[model samples]
Target: MTAKLADKYGPWGVVAGGSDGVGAAFAHRIAAAGINVVLVARRVPVLEACADEIRAEHGVDVRTVALDLSASDAVARLVDATADVEVGLFVYNAGADDISVPFLDKDVDTHLSLVRRNCGAVLEAAYRFGGPMVERERGGVVLVTSGAAWAGGASLAAYGATKAFDLVLAESLWAEWRGHNVDVLSLVLGMTDTPSLRRTLAAKGDAAPDGIATPDDVAETALRHLGDGPTWIHGAGDPTGPSPLGALPRRDAVLAMSRSWAEE
Candidate 1:
């Protein structure tokens, strides 16, 4: 994306999962645009490290907030915590994976917890902070949903559902906030190279294959789309190629493909 374009869209950005990987890269790019950033994450040390880099390189004010967003009270805390700052960009990127087990083998608690973290927290953040952005009559909201959101993946049943919820919710918000200048975006990401992905592979005792996307790649693509101001961006396949399979209804197709990953 063009530097001028980034500057045009950003001056203050908040990243909910800004401590590492894709989220951290978003922070960096925004900071490079001379935007002050507010980093939110569960680990203080991680947030401090990310903040330090942005501060040193971009000379942007970095504020770190340590909070576990999986907690039911997290959204309220986040709003209260950042209430004083005027953020022009909001990225709802925090997420929890579905239980990596057979449907019958998964625990109910884990499923509910994932829903609360992935769907509920994202909704709360978007609405609470997003309302103010609309009132301000200028701002952007980017939601990090998964490619799986476009369909039902039985292996990731809970996660897929929550991501679907995130995508649809953002789209609705876009329509609602269209005339208000609050640009709402929903990013559908494929498998990205992150610590979480590595950990998942290790836990499943699987070898690294090919075609996994890096955090930097994901960040760059997302920023490009955000700068382009597209309502929805797909991660895998060419950006202009095939018109995004997710754009079509493929619930059964996704569930079939998910079964292959389940055994892995």
Candidate 2:
């Protein structure tokens, strides 16, 4: 598996938001496949620590780039930092909205920041990294999204919109790049067991529900299915199937989504 992955998408991989949780899991898994990794995140200490652990555990070269993906120049900085490497695999996993509140409750700046990170940065990374992959005719790109993307809901407006953008972007890229042998997956996650999710739940005086997906499982599933392009629903019975809400009317789907948030 290691040699095969290295041959196909190897040399080096880049994991944005790789300091912890799903991003860290991706870095570890990629390293285990005998690929060097560049881990990018805003938290310097955590990022370095994750890098060190990957180096120790997998004996793969690990580079840390402390960067805030929300920044306008984040992808430019990332390209500069990684210009020396042949990045055959790129995973954009940084867009997790911790604030689940009514749209008007949060200021415009907060929403804008989310947009910049989730939509702008994702698009930039995919274009810059995926272009080379297509030219080389081999590589993989994973865009981490969420089930919230299936429909709009109260308190999930901005986040869902951005994730929906990611979903369509990944699918479109897959269609365009499939002939080039470059795989693109929009990883749609439901309730996942991650520090970010834990914190968000705790803020609401709640705990993680049973059967929530694990970061390692999600990462493993994605790596295994890198060739299964377009989209992958992490915990769904039919991973490549249409959304569960697909049959419903748009208004009904939105109402269902709103109720789910209210229950949570």
Q: Give all candidates' CA lDDT scores.
A: 0.77, 0.94
Error of 1 at 18 (Å): 0.8
Per-residue lDDT for 165-235 in model 1, tens only? 98888878888887887878877777777766677777777655687777777776677666334345555
Residues 1-264 of candidate 2: C-alpha lDDT, one tens digit per residue: 567889999999999999899999999999999999999998888999999999999999998889899999999999999999999999999989986999999999999999999999999999999999999999999999999999999999999999999999999999999999999999999988999999999999999998889999999999999889789999899999989999999999999999998998
Pick by TM-score: which candidate is best? 2
TM-score of each: 0.89, 0.99
What RMSD does model 2 have?
0.7
Q: lDDT score, residue 32, model 2?
A: 97
Model 2 lDDT, residue 169, Cα: 95
User: Candidate 1, clashing residue pairs?
Assistant: none
